[model samples]
Target: MLFGKKKEKVHFNPGNRDDGVDENFVEETVNKIDEDDVEVVLKNEENIDKKFSGNNSLSKYMELGRIMVSMLKDVKNGRYKNIPWFTIATVVMALLYVLNPMDIVPDFIPGVGYIDDVAVLTMGVGWIESDLHRYLDWRLENDLGI
Candidate 1:
């Protein structure tokens, strides 16, 4: 008789979509990033190559960093949250590239390996640009600028 007990029903309801934080919104924003923007960001080697300013450009970088944290938090809180697949893909690919014995351009060639890391990360970060903008606005409103 104990084994025959009925299982409870599971219900699912998608959360509100108005907030810019929605995964669909983030995904759409990332998908819209074009080659020109990539080129612009990449061409400025100073921006890409230099170590992230301790505080300068801090807001933009923090915006991205926050989204990553927030996504994890939301998921932990039982919300129907989803991280954009592309972000995961980029990170995984980068890690795989590192683990593989062979590389497109060996790390032995100074600067090239770091450049590849920057490029992949830049693309992943750029995907969440819209969320970053929202995060920046929040930082600005709260006077949190670096």
Candidate 2:
């Protein structure tokens, strides 16, 4: 029987993927955030801009989530180019990781569990920080009507 060539597997390892995010950094950052106390980070960039400040880590966390959304949106709108595949994968994976009920640490665990989600978000943001900054600058310029 003839058949097409078998496709290579594409694995996305959130803990140690490319785009420069290492496990060490993610673990360290995750340990610092009080996941149990995390609240709504932000509703919009303007809110982040106005409300993000020193000692406001929750807001920054939300900002990272929003940045992921914005990046995905920009990709859909054809505003981004040459985006690294790992970056895209990281964002989608992180988003999914956050919502997945069955993870290394389940979300229903209450206090300590959300830390995993936060860790995913934090590391995902770290991997795509430059891309996020570029998108953020573009967004700010366009939003300002400049």
Candidate 3:
């Protein structure tokens, strides 16, 4: 019973929860994203930056967001075709998830609202981390300045 209590506590912790955003939901949303969605993210770049720059757990992933945005822009302009469609979609999904206020955890909640966002962003970054590094290298080689 003591061990069960410990397990329950850990399960409830946002940082350790396994019931975060669903992969199917992410895939469905990502599939629907188009040029307009990309435009929305680009237009709200400053807002996104502000969200990530805030003093929270999500702040650490700010660089990841920046890399994703840069990759999205390049892909949009056809300057980066080396990335797979799934990677592009995953990045878009993550960015859009941040922009959405009514996600798995509503952003209005104090102290814990961004937990799910961070989880989603983390998952997306994990899925595309290698591609992101490759993109950065490409940028450097081409003088694109990552």
Candidate 4:
């Protein structure tokens, strides 16, 4: 009977399904998308670097709390004055991480982790290394060992 066939229960299990459908398809698709996305992002970032790496502002204190703390300590101790743009970038990224509605690793997944936050933070730090010395030196001279 049509209704009887519809009512019959059919169970599909990834490990035990008798049909030739490969259960790993879903996992493979997700992995491929992740890889492709990463490559595209890297290319885009490289292009952006060539255009606007200069004249960027430092991140706000709230965004770069640790860096801010360090800089602030230096300021109080008379060691530094202005925070660097890279430092600001790190903070801005942090702010995005904390406040952004979208997560690098979507929150829905149970086991996998997030890496976008780390990537941005790393880029920011690397960008700031060269200017760090100059900023620190200026702070030291103006703040008298802060």
Q: Estimate each model's TM-score.
A: 0.33, 0.56, 0.76, 0.33
Q: Rank by lDDT, descending? A: 3, 2, 1, 4
**lDDT of prediction 3:** 0.73
- Runs of candidate 3 with Cα error greater than 4 angstroms are 1-26
**Evaluated with TM-score, which candidate comes out highest?**
3
lDDT tens per residue, model 1, 17-132 = 33333555444544444433333333443432233333454345434443443433333343412334343333233333333324666545654543454444455555545544
lDDT of candidate model 4 versus the reference: 0.38
The per-prediction tally of clashing pairs is: 0, 0, 0, 9
Global CA lDDT computed for model 2: 0.54
Candidate 2, residues 1-146, lDDT tens digits: the string is: 00111222234445455656555654444333331212222123344333223235556666666667566556545565535545555566666556566788885675665677777777677767777777678778778211
Q: By the lDDT metric, which is better: model 2 or model 3? A: 3
Q: Estimate every model's Cα lDDT from 0 to 1.
A: 0.39, 0.54, 0.73, 0.38
> Lowest lDDT 10-mer window, candidate 4?
1-10
Say which candidate scores most in lDDT: 3
Point out where model 2 deviates above 4 Å.
Answer: 1-57, 144-146
Sort by TM-score, top down from the best: 3, 2, 1, 4
- Cα-based lDDT at residue 20, candidate 4: 48
